[model samples]
Target: MQMASTPTTGDRFRQLIRSLTGISLPPSKVQMIDQRLRRRVVEYGLPDTEAYLEKLLAGELPQDELPRVIDLITTNTTSFFRESEHFDFLTGHILPDRLAKARAEGRKRFKLWSAASSEGAEAFTAAMVLEEARRKGAGFDYAILGTDISARMLERATAAIYADEQLTTVPRDLVTRYFLRADDPSMAGKARIVPELRARTRFRHLNLMDKSYAVDRDVDVIFLRNVLIYFDATDKEQVVDRLAGHIAKGGYLLVGHAESMIVRHPLLRQVKPTIFQKC
Candidate 1:
């Protein structure tokens, strides 16, 4: 008796994922993707990765499935205040001066966008800073909007729950003032952001690859940190242009400390390391 061969479904699946997401999957990632999407394959009644790729190629999967694929692909390594210097730049140099100038011009409100907000830390961190400014009588009306392609992470962001281990980078003062320690014994070592801080920021589902994004025209700042490394050069350009389009004139674009726009984009000018001003 002869048995049917179990095909190299994982390798083919990796290729399909790379084609769609521009994520170059290595042989080492085969098992990772298989584990992440095995349930989806089962749920779809697909026999193997080949069949799954066929469905994705044919657009037969539900709309939400694509983001699930993105979730599996995009690396979202982030923590509360993971890159602290950017926040320092915001508080010390950017906010104080931008707020003063806008107030003098009678512009009473501002908006900020955290374009690749993962797990809500960056957005909420912005809120904490803005809240402090507001309390100090800076008198600038402000709100922060955080968007990401990962629905799973966005759900966690909305829930505002975190283990103490996840918050190692957050400031001690913020941990004390903003997060309520979970009282239940089983949930000890966990905390939730206080309602006031949570209320100050909004989370939304946004895909960088989506054809259109309706960002507010007068956005004062955009933080799209540490996300461009995944995209190819062309994708990097497009995403930069899209995110930069939302910046109000004289507003700034902040990328990761190691990321840059030195690639001849006509719409931006470098004002500082990893910072660009919309022209």
Candidate 2:
């Protein structure tokens, strides 16, 4: 019998990534993949990238290894109030408008979803804004749900702890009001989001490429920011369509400022550069 031909390193990596995350890694990103996975390869005692890919592709690796690979590959760069304009719009226009409409309808609760919430910064920042609004006399209750594909990211998000530099964009007064300094000397320069804010937020594992989303249908606003850049056009359209189904009529959907859509959906209208409203 003839021996089977071995797959090339590039082909194996491409197939693994596409099968797991529905993301296509361009040739330019091969170096980035190597950089990210080098440590994992060592940790697993694999001799090189080829050995790591072989174990992963052959299904001989531990069950948890795949999740770790996904976690390592997924980007989790975020900061408190990273895009200040989105939060400003949320507090100044969207929340107030939604509050008035909800009050008129005799509803007292508002829901926000941080669909790609990594490390919880976006969700916690949103909680701070809502709490501040309440202090300014907005008469409505609010809750936030943060979701991500990486369990590792979700773990950090649930912890709600951050280094001082991660919060420079936040106003001093809000930081004083919403965050507590870490007590341990070894943890100096770190702060924890106060329990009150954490109480209004929750984190869960979510993959945008999944066939169906398991979230509430009456969400008032969704911050799906800085995530679509990893997806191709088809995945982007599918995700937008599916998310639109979960949004209440007249609700808002916020994407990254750098992202734009060539084809507009009928139910979603671009109200701002990166902000869409449901019809």
Candidate 3:
């Protein structure tokens, strides 16, 4: 009789990543994963990605190392207002309607969640636009929550610091209005979200795979863009359904343009190609 052979380090690594984050690692991602984890392999003096995975899966490393591993493996690509049109709809359609309803209902607070916020850019972008509305006498207050699987990203998000290049997509006036340059000589090119806007925004570490999020179920809008592309069909569906549950009735869910065709949940109705409204 033949003995059963153990799965390769890459196979177990991929499975664990999917189980933890619902992110699929296709064959095409093999090179990318190895590339991303290369630093960790060297840092631990491991022979290769396989060795690093063995240590990680066996819990042989520090208690805190697993989170750091997840951070390195997960992709976090974002920019301020990467999809400008989303912000346009946000300020033009959603805000007006939500604000009007708020005024009529005697409510002052509005909430927006960046479901996969990376380094706080999207959340801060929303903050900038919402703050502008308040300045124009929209007369409503808002709080923004940014959640990511990467603690490294969340820490940077909480810091609210951004490089100058990251502000290119942000309009000049808004940049001046919302950011303050770092005084530290070592951080010259970086700027941070001003106190007022930073005060209204917060970041937390969250895995969308969790059965329930520790977020407000009455959230007004959720920007769950870009991140779903990493998930498989089943995982993607589960994530959307879970996200939809957190949205208040009549609130909105925005996905990436590439993911527009993928949003098909019973609780959500497509009002636009990439925009869905909760029923």
lDDT of each: 0.79, 0.89, 0.91
- Candidate 1 residues 133-201, lDDT tens each? 778787777888899878888998898888999878877887888889766896788899889988778
Ranking by TM-score: 3, 2, 1
Q: Number of the top candidate by lDDT?
A: 3
**RMSD (Å) of each candidate, 1 decimal:** 5.3, 2.9, 1.9
Q: What's model 1's TM-score?
A: 0.83
RMSD value for candidate 2? 2.9
Compute the lDDT of residue 152 as modeled in candidate 1. 83
Per-prediction TM-score to the true structure, in the order listed? 0.83, 0.95, 0.95
- After superposing candidate 3 on the true structure, give the runs of residues whose Cα lies further than 4 Å from its correct spot: 1-6
Native-vs-model 1 lDDT? 0.79
For candidate 2, write residues 32-68 as lDDT tens digits.
8888889988998888877887788888788998898
The pairs that clash in candidate 2 are none
**lDDT per residue (tens digit) for residues 205-237 in model 3:** 899999889898888899999999999999889
* Stronger candidate by lDDT (1 vs 3): 3
